[model samples]
Target: MDTTDDARTRIDTTVAHPARRYNYWLGGKDHFAADRASGDAIAAAMPGVKLMAVENRAFMGRAVRYLAEQGIRQFLDIGTGIPAPNNTHEIAQSVDPSSRVVYVDNDPIVLTHARALLTSAPGGANAYIDGDLRDPEAILAHPDLPATLDLSRPVALLLVAVLHFIREDEHPERIIETLTAALAPGSYLVASHATWEYLPAEVIAALTRNNTDGRFQARTAARFAELLAPFDLVEPGIESVAYWHADDVPGPRPSAEEVACFGAVARIR
Candidate 1:
């Protein structure tokens, strides 16, 4: 919310971008008309998408807290959308104030709002990288990352709700491998991906057709599991984003069919 005029200058509201569209789904005010249009189309195709956004957010909080409690004090959260409450660093710093975080996103709007994303608690550090996940090397070599996190120690690599935008043809797995390979052996991988395995055939067809122009590639549950090939999955394994380590939160449970996302946390060892 610390957006400035200079930051807003980089944004192009004429075209819909992933981060802005996602923000629109999460009921954030950081999006444009183009993003709202795309988000509305998806909601019309699948009414539960808003629920997926909410649950995916919850999963990120729980996973980050779990990692911090496990002594992971560094975080590399890629695909960090617009500034939101309880973000990666906020959750981690709440558990361990010394946590360091590097947030990366290609969206111009996100880069413009760097001030909000860069705020960190005392004893913690936060930095922003204007990079894309499609190019892992550039992000890995970014100067801001090394300044904030230690590659020699454990770091949590977050890819929540980002990979689906990269087509399977783009070799998303290879991109992930490139990033994880550079981390220390004790590093962790926390991810939440969109999956259409739970929808009916007709709904899936509609959703696919609606998103073809938008370039959203929703995968099945099994294929989603393969992305974690480099790491060992934690207890309870891959499940709906809403259900992963969510027993502590008091609320009426949402079914996997409603959430429509595959979420998991894995260890590099």
Candidate 2:
């Protein structure tokens, strides 16, 4: 990871970063004015945008917990946004104190706050790598990652709420393949991605037109599932993040339209 000054110099406060915007949506204080503007603009187009963010976050927590309960003690979480409550390591370590996790993110601001994500339990270990999801090879080769997680073991790969930012031209499927190829069989792929399938055509058009940063590219359920090729979807399949393993959540959950994201956990086959 870069030093604090190096990371700070790399950060462009003028532009809105996805991690910062997401932090703003989650009501965190790490975002700049640009992020708030971007978030507010999206919210104006889709009133339930905040709900989508919240539901997606909840899905990540549930997925991590489920993986931990299934005896997965190692996690590689990419696109780790600003450290929020019950982060990957926190949830996994809560299940098993000896759990180990490696978090990767591209945002320099996130790197500045990486210390928060590195706080592991007494028996567990956590590491943060300043890397991009678009470059799987680089992330996989990061020294901290290898030191924290053993690829030969059945580690869980968490891509929650981050794949949508990967444009089609970037070949997100290839990225998934590259990363999963490094993991051993029995490794789990847990992901939640934004989808346009639940939105009306007009709403989609409006949102698309309003998208100025071109940071988000919502995919359909089928497309998202395709990215998980060679991996079998766990029971319940790809469904709204609001409802995916959400039995423990309070009643009167938001509608699919309100939380327009598909989430699922799949296993390497």
Candidate 3:
């Protein structure tokens, strides 16, 4: 549990942040007034925004469970937001008590909440790396990462709902390659990103503007495919967060209206 305590007071409550806003949308108590304001504005524009958050979390749990059941003992979850129930470590360790997880986030508030998310099983471990997704090397080289994870073994790397925050100009491919290539062949890469392919023109414009704080980068279908190219995609390929690995549990799925996210799970060679 390498949580950074030097950042609690440094967090600004002025501009909204993706992680804090997301926490607000998910009904978490760690968000600020600015986050709530931003989240409410986005929700007003897209009524399904909260639904997307919930579904994305469900997808995370399913993906972690799937990987753990496949015997993945280590996990690297980048862009981890405020502490929430059914976190990566919880889901994975429930399947196998020896599972170890390291969560990474750049948000200072998220770092403040890191300790709450670090509860681990007796035989397992959970740690947090206060770093950015753009700097995968720093995360990989962090002291707590290697202390809890075995790079030579299969690891499930989760980038769920966070890549959208990284603009395309950042060369997301190189980052993915660097992280995925460092893992064992049986390792898995699971991510969910926002896409314009599911939204209408007007809605896209408004949503894009809402994210104009230089935080998220909405991508297209083609670009999404390129990110998953480094690994062999699992069944059903990349699809809507609600459609990927969807179980037969209920009513009609979210309409094709304006989905800005797609999810996929792939394995390294």
Clashing pairs in 2: none
Worst 10 residues of 2 by lDDT: 206-215
Task: Summarize candidate 3's per-residue lDDT along 107-219 as a digit string, tens digits.
Answer: 99887777777889989999988889899888888899888899898889999998887776787888888888789888899999876666677877887788766667878
Which scores greater on lDDT, model 1 or model 3?
Answer: 1
In order of appearance, the predictions have TM-scores of: 0.95, 0.97, 0.94
Better of 1 and 3 by TM-score: 1
Give all candidates' CA lDDT scores: 0.90, 0.90, 0.84
Runs with alpha carbons beyond 4 Å of true place in candidate 1: 1-9
**Which parts of model 2 have CA positions greater than 4 angstroms off?**
none
Local lDDT at 9 for model 1: 76
Question: Model 1, range 16-80, lDDT digits (tens) per residue?
Answer: 88899888988899998988988898788899999999999989999999999999999999999
Worst 10 residues of 3 by lDDT: 1-10
